[model samples]
Target: MFDIKQYLQEQRQLVEEALRQYMLAAEGDFAAHIETMRYSLFVGGKRIRPILCLTAARCVSDEPDVDMLLLPAACALECIHTYSLIHDDLPAMDNDDLRRGQLTCHKKFGEAEAILAGDGLLTYAFELISSEQFLGLSLEVRLRLIAVLARAAGSLGMVGGQFLDIASEGKEIPFALLKTIHRSKTGALITAAVQMGAIGGGAVAAQLQALTEYGGAVGLAFQIVDDLLDVTSSSKQLGKTAGHDAGQGKATYPAFFGVEKTRALAIEAAERAVAALVGFDERANPLRALARYIVSRTN
Candidate 1:
């Protein structure tokens, strides 16, 4: 049997080491600014996006150094994810004081500094992906990867979903709109991570399609589990403020379908994600385990 926990820990270590190597060092006149960015980047959290990126590459390729080849892009994905978390925890956004059991970036460093840090990380993500380190990839492949990241992180995806989430607060929204919000805000980048990895790994058209389907299902499952956790788990268990969704009157799976049904939906989505990889071989087992792991995770 595959040990999902072990897989995650090992993959996370690889990503963390790469992040430390590739991330900007805090130095010189801009030391404080860089420190704020590094603080959130280094602060603990599940490095799910980058893990997904690397795992997806493994699924599609047999190259001995595929993971190393994709490390820069995987680290870039983490940078984008970290930037989103920092901005999401801002006072103007979720207003949370804790993240990964530590003070939120804005709370520890100042609101303005946190905002700039997010911006810096966001921009740095592109820089890292586009740097000469990634030139090993074909120009066309590199461009596609960059485009995928941009579209997922831009106004049409994560940003747009965030806008809808904030706007829908304290208001009853249709189930469809709520899904749109979740898909864009959370699913877009998650799917993009998989897509980029598939592209980098040279997955053929059919494999890419399968991975895209898998990504969408896993992403949906991830958000559903997150919503359920907000209602059922304590802040200490979650490493962040729990029940904030209810406090802010945010639309969530628990609020819409209740905890039991939401939990079932999450499981169902995870199953769908696994089913999407039926055509793949043993190399895709990690992706399958990851989907199941996402729904079952408590924090």
Candidate 2:
């Protein structure tokens, strides 16, 4: 049988090693700033975005060292993800005290330092994506990848969704609005991760289209699970403050559909995610399993 747990652990370790090698050191004249940036980036998490990016690249590419070729892009994704998490936990946002079972960046390093750290990571992501070291990948491909990531993580995507979320706080938002927020805030980056991998691996239009569909479904499902976890799990289990959705009066699947219906919706989304991979064979099995894994994850 295919062991998803083992596969996840192995991939996670690969991502961990790559991150350590690619990350900046906290040893320069700007040591404290770099340390603050490294603080949250090195903190324990599943490293799902980078892993998904690399796996998507492998699925599309026949190159033996696709992982090496795509390591920079994978690292970029992680940096962007880490930056979002750092800002999300700030007092102005979620106001959470913990993340990945450690103090939030703002709490650990103070607000100003944390803000700069987030800014540093966000800018560094694009820098890594366009670095001269990744010159082997054609200029066109790198530009495309950078453009895709920019649109996803920029004001028109993740940031826009966050703005809508904070604006709608303490008010009853319609289900459609909530979905818009989730799709932009959470789903966009996840889609970008897979799309970036596909672009790096030289995917054609059709293959990219299929993977985009798959990513969209999986990303939405991920947010649905997060909504469920906010109500059903504890901070100790999630490694961050839970129940924030309800406390903030934010709209969620559970808020509109109840837990059982929300669970059913999550399963449906996962099923759609797997169905989108119909064109691929066993090579895409990891993506298929990941769909189910998202709903079943504890945190």
Candidate 3:
């Protein structure tokens, strides 16, 4: 069996090093602004999105050195994800003080700087993908990755879902709308992470479709687990405020189906994600493990 914990540690270290190398310095004129951005990017988390991007690339590629080729795109995904988190924790959004066990960007650096930092990170993601300096990727692939990621992170996807979430808060939200919120707000980027990886690896149309299915299911499962953790885990364990969803009257799987049923639903989603990988061989084992890990995680 694959040792997921060890694999995660190795991949995390690899990605952290890549992030350090790729990260822009906080020097020159905009020092404070860059420093604010640096603070959030370095604050610790699992780095799941980038790892998924790399692993998905590995799954589709037979080459031993495929990770190196995909690292830039993976880092780009992390930038986008980190930016979303920064914006999500703002007072106008989720309105909490903690992320990755540290004060949120808005709380530590003030709202304006945090907003700018988030904007900087979000725009920088595209810069990373589109820049001529980012080598080893064809222009066509880079453009396609840029387009896909833009849609996932933009108005019709994560941003739109966030709009719906803020709009529906305190209202009696139905299950259908709740799924929409989860799929758009959280699921789209997750899917994009895998999709971007597949694109980076030069996957075929069928492999791309299969990974999309896996990404979508796993993304839903990840959100459901997040909702469960908010209710069941402590702030210390979660690295943020617990019960925040219910306190804010945010719709969640547990809110709709209760804890036990929500747990079952998460399991189902993970199963779907794993099932979607049946077309691949043992190269996909890491993804399978990751999908299963989504439900078991405490934070």
Candidate 4:
């Protein structure tokens, strides 16, 4: 049996180690600012984005130390993810007090510091990906990776989705628009994680296309499951404020479809994600398992 739990733990360790090595040290004149960034970055989380990047690379390449080769890109994905979380928990956004079971960056470090920390992480992600450390990839490939990440994290993607989500609060929105919000806000970065791995691993066009499809399905499943958890789970279980979406009047899968229907949708998306991997061999088993895991995750 492919033990998904063990696989997640091992991959998460690799991601955490890489993050520690590549992240800026909180010292010197800017110690205060950097410390806030480190505080949020080092706080506990699933580390799913970076793990997806590494696993997607493994699916395409059997090269020696392929995970090591893609560490910079993987770490960059995590940085961007962490930065988003920090900003999301700000008073102007979700206004949550807890994240990953710890005080939010803004709550612990003040609003201005949290904003700067988010900004620092966002900019540092690009710096890491563009730096000389991400060796083995050609200049063209590197540029492509950068572009993919930028588009996913920028206004057209996550930012745009967030704007739409906030705007739609307290208003009943069509299901189609809700999907658009989810796809841009949550799905784009998740898909980009897989795409970056494929590009870095030298996947051919067909392989990239298949992986992209898989990424899209997985992203949809992930957001749906999140919506379900928001309604079904507790804040303690989520390590953050649960039911905040309902309180904020945010449109969600559960809001459109009941709990059971929303859960069914999540399963359907996971199935589609798995179907997209039919072209790959056993190397893609992790991706398949991850798709299933996304829908089943409790937090």
TM-scores, in order shown? 0.99, 0.98, 0.99, 0.99
Give me the overall lDDT of model 4: 0.93
Please identify which of the two predictions, 1 or 3, would achieve the higher lDDT against the true structure: 1
Model 1, position 183, has a per-residue lDDT of 98
Q: After superposition, how far is residue 132 of candidate 2 from its true place, in Å?
A: 1.6
Clash counts for all predictions: 0, 0, 0, 0
lDDT of 2 at 129: 83
Query: Model 2: per-residue lDDT, tens digit, 1-299?
Result: 67888998998888888778877888979999999999999998888888888878888888978878888888898899999999988899989899989999999999999999999999999999888878768899999999999999998889999999999999988888999999999999999999998899888899899999989999999999999999999998999888988898899999999999999999999999999889987878888898899899999
Q: Which ten residues in a row have the lowest lDDT in candidate 1?
A: 133-142
Q: Please give the distance, in angstroms, between residue 148's alpha carbon in candidate 3 and its true position after superposition.
A: 0.9
- Over 1-299, each residue of candidate 4 has an lDDT whose tens digit, in order, gives 89999999999999899999999998899999999989998998898989988899999998967878889889889889999999988889889999988999999999999999999999999999899877778899889989999999999999899889889999999999999999999999999999999988889999999999999999999999999999999999999899989999999999899999999999999999999999999999999999999999999
**CA lDDT for candidate 2:** 0.90
